[model samples]
Target chain A: MSSSANHAVSYPRFLVRLLSVATDGGLQFYAWMTFLTAIALVGANAWAHQVADGMVLTHMTDHVSWGLYIANFTFGVGLAAGGVMMVIPAYLYDDHAMHDVVIFGEILAIAAIVVCIGFVGVDIGRPDRIWHMIPGVGRFNWPMSMLTWDVLVLNGYLVLNLHIVGYLLYHRFTGRKPNKRWYMPFVMASIVWAISIHTVTAFLYAGLGGRPFWNSALLAPRFLASAFVSGPAFIVLLLLAMRWLSDLKIGAGPIRTLVSILRVTTVVNLFMLASEVFVEFYTGGSHTAAAQYLFFGLEGHNDLVPWMWTSIVFNVVAAGIFLTRKGIEDNRFLVAACVLTFMGVWIEKGMGLIIPGFIPSTLHEIVEYAPSLVEWKVTAGIWALGGLVLTVGVKCGVAVLSGHERLVKG
Target chain B: MSDSADGVSRRTLLKAAGATLGAAAFAQALAPLASWAEGMSSEDFLATHYKELDAEGLKTALKRIEEDTKKKTGVDVHVTADAPIPGVKFGYALNLSICIGCRKCAEACHEENNHDRKTNNSYIRVFEMDKGSIDFAKGTVDYAHPVPQPDKFYMPVQCQQCDNAPCVSVCPVEATWKEADGIVVVDYDWCIGCRYCEAACPYHARRFNWQAPEVPAKEINPDQGYLSNRLRPQGVMEKCHFCLHRTRKGKLPACLEACPTGARVFGNLLDPDSEIRWVLANKRVFVLKEELGTKPSFFYFFDE
Candidate 1:
């Protein structure tokens, strides 16, 4: 027999052979889940302590009222926003090469949403009373409260997208083609929903007149641009990991296409960021004080400068990596580039977005803020929880697709 | 038995039973309203956000207020109807030059409105600017230490209660609204703890209760105004109300009374002889951030 023919037969039996390997992998997965749960429990306990003691337990003082929780929330939002780039190809362009990988994107979205929600819970002093936000019973609907809509859209989108993705995977495992007609509508809805979630979140910051750094017309667009670049970079990095670990081949053609898209999106994001900087400095208005504090460090609070400069450098480097042939083609280089891009976007979207908004605050006071250890550990727990969710989701998806388990076990 | 006496007794018994039933039903219907009315004074009775109470509830509340006012202040204060401006709705004004920066306003505000003592957060920020710099652009309101620096003059800026208030416009849920009497009030229960209003207010007038306010019952200022100083739920936004309970009832704001310089003035702009109107017409009054077109009711002036 020809070597190619032999490989084809063996590949079909790959899952059967890998079933033994999965047993060991399952043990690892359980261990990881247990570790994550323990961390989450500890974090939750600490959070309860914070609630009992008030925000005094947090290192966050009036000057730096918003700290790690907000930063993590912003980072999670950015990560969630990144799902759009992955969706665009599968839904809009109908790229078949991306079909297997699309589930991973949805998994990431689910994980990101959990982290986002978790961060919000930790940030609020009275998280137990969060149900008061429900309409009709407590002040059900507040058109003036962007938070109300954000809750609705974010949770709604997360569920809808997750359901649609789950349904597709179920059918794929059952040896039945998914009813494309049903998924088509969800796909369309997801596109619009994705845009809405990020836009509304941006408005949450941009609408604030007190925080000059956040109060800009460019904010919403800037958010979208950053999401487009960062989201794709994350997906690409995951695809590389999958390529090494599994037999799933995300073709070079798709990687190149995604890289090209990232190249354009990163440019747009950079442009928007530059324009914002120019307007702040050039206008020479009362608002310039906030921008000065963010970039140059007003007074002695220069804590953010090193971090901000690093973000700028990493962003530039990531953009450079996408533009170059060597960076995008080589697997190792691609991983490094994507990792840098992810971290860069995290800093830019997290600290760069939130801290700057409050510095040279409305009162023209430079308040220095840093997150405490408890805050950091809680954030880490939330991140681990997100990863755990994504891992389980991807594992379930892969299992079903490979048809390792019988569709009709009962 | 005397037949006439028996008949009269029967009628009286029937009337007494009917009156008892009527009173019981009235009490049952007014249960929530009555509970709310327990500690509130008459001045505060009429000045609630109005949106909070239904018609029957409002009537009962108003009656309760009248009763409370007579008991507390020992004065007969009439609560009158003042229609909100057609399109203008509500606005606020403050005089920077007249402000002593003593923070009596802030303290009075804290006391009048049950606020968290640890944070000591209040809506009003008294900026002490340099004496020579009449320009607000050169003003430095945030100082690390004690106030009234040698070269400084004080400006107390609270909720501009802007005609075009950004905070009101940006609220995703309609938890906050502008009332007819030129006051911006937030529904404590309705606020989702988003801090959007805090972000939106140019004056930084709004504060979010990160934790439940820790005010002692003794310090709770039993004479509560529902909209101005009622115990707030954690996560909601709050701000200064210009002492709605007092000002609406023809009494002076606590801050105005406490001011050593008598620099503060309080009155209705509609009232021709009202001191606020007089200050606006006679003095070289200027509103903060007039360029932003927030159309603040708070005015600043210097006595020549």
Candidate 2:
């Protein structure tokens, strides 16, 4: 379309049109992509070092076997699950304003799930051995291992979401009406599947009875509450960024609706945290040792004290901001609240939740952990990869929806 | 699919799908070689599940372990993959009255099992407690004294080898399992090193290999079992198997032999006349965390 000679030779013009959008990045887009790609390469290099030198290079030890890698993995799962918040309201209620933005949620989910899988890949010691975890090809002890269930559900959700998104977009690009029968059921299933992914991940921790810090029945509920809070908050930030940068027509209606949802979820998340805290402190059981390490210093290992407190403060302040009508109306205040909420949940759910479960390990040994530089680099890289994927996906999505790209009828 | 110069074609989508699937399948076909280059041999990469191994496959695995040990440690190790003896479920009972907190059993297990020297990992942990309490928080494993204090009692905890093991049930890959003789054994090579079993074990009996174990060439225990005392690879889980190599061949476990007080008893529970059965009959014996219903073969009692 831009050049006459190349346009004349096009056979697969729908794909060509999608490819053109990615290729037609202005200076700003190219710079953003280049920066993301460069950082992603650094992450790849660090991963190479980890693969060569073994996990000893990581901040994790036998005492704290799952570290930042698993932390990010858990967070990534919640992030992916958050997409359903948008889906539930938009499709179920037939809120056309929100429906216009639902595709963004799906795209965000696709990005989050990809990052989740990447984190798992970097976390495992032997990347090549992953094939063994696949069903039928190797021994997958389903109904036995919670991790096996996690693998199944995460992948199943990925495929399910992929189908839903691909079906809608493919129809939109081709100018054909989507068959509601085929895609609507999947959209509904994805809502449940999204919640299930986070619940199962929580169970992955909770099922381990030995780690009393994680053995609580409240964990799954807490995961859902926090996931709903942080997930929507992140979507707000992304939607804001998209609106500012591009002509995405995401009006204030969806943002306010998302904020209201965030408000309720954040309140529940904080309440659950309070519930967990009161039980740990008041009961004075052996299970309190890990919780003790997280809040107060346990036997002089108080490294996480500052981080935990900061997360608590951020969460409390942000929740208050979102609860107020004025804060919801003011874009600046809303942005601050969302950022704080995102950071608060990231720390709370990741290190605050995961690390405490392992500290003062059931054997009562206190070996504190700090993620190594290499671990941070790897994490940053995965984030950059997510950014790149989302950018490319949204570019194509915007193009097809704007009618700049189309499939000619036969 | 028709050629359209002005719009997209179905042919392009099909070609891309074909190319992506072709590349993925081609890469997967060569993954065994890639895995072989990354420390696993082709044989180990292609090795079937432990339960799926037949007599011939087991024989080949045993020989490979022997060769692998020799190559890695320069120690000509005898690696045996033993099967359970039917109708002979093993049981152990510790006489708490006469036991001292020397921790020699812990040391023997460390050497016998080829644990990493840096981590100082041992399957057995001896806790010294005040006479009146069974509370583990009040117990100390790192006592600097030479012998048990006069008023103190010793309790050595290891894998309970539960009849219904939570660790076995939690393993996503079936890398660990309980044999008929009540020994919970881990297939070290097959384990994904997820440490879910370590987290699942109530007794904290499991140890994860953060690095490939380094046993000094001269000190390496040449007697090894494929699922028990063999030198383990990095990122896998290892634990006590009651010294299955020696016990399956009618010898006492290294920990039991190392106990200077002779407070440890090992026997087949199926034999009503065995010493463990007698301990169960005569003494007030109890298994650790029995409320969890793990049904441990290991028991503790006092002679008082």
- DockQ, per model, reads 0.14, 0.32
lDDT of each residue in A1-410, candidate 1, tens digit only: 68578446644554443342233243556577567656765566566556655555677644455777887787787678677677788768888877777778878888889989999877875444465566664454556556776888889889877888767865664455778787878877887888888888888887765666887889888888888877888888777766766565567766776788888988788888899888889898677876677678776778888888888888888888878887776877778778887888888888878877777656665667877777876787788778767766666666655554434443
For A168-281, candidate 2 gives per-residue lDDT tens digits of: 777777777888999889999999999999999999899876788998999999999988988899889988998888776778989989998988888999999999999999
**Superposed model 2: Cα runs more than 4 Å off:** A1-13, A408-410, B1-38
Candidate 1's TM-score: 0.81
Per-residue alpha-carbon lDDT of model 2 for B42-88, expressed as tens digits? 78666677788899989888898889888877889888887888888
Docking class of 2: acceptable
Largest DockQ belongs to which candidate? 2
The TM-score values for the models, in the order shown, are: 0.81, 0.91
- Per-residue lDDT tens digits of candidate 1, residues B146-248? 6656678888877777777777776655557777767887765455555556656767677777666776545656565656676665546788777777666
Model 2, position B244: C-alpha lDDT score:
89
- Candidate 1 lDDT score at position B123: 67
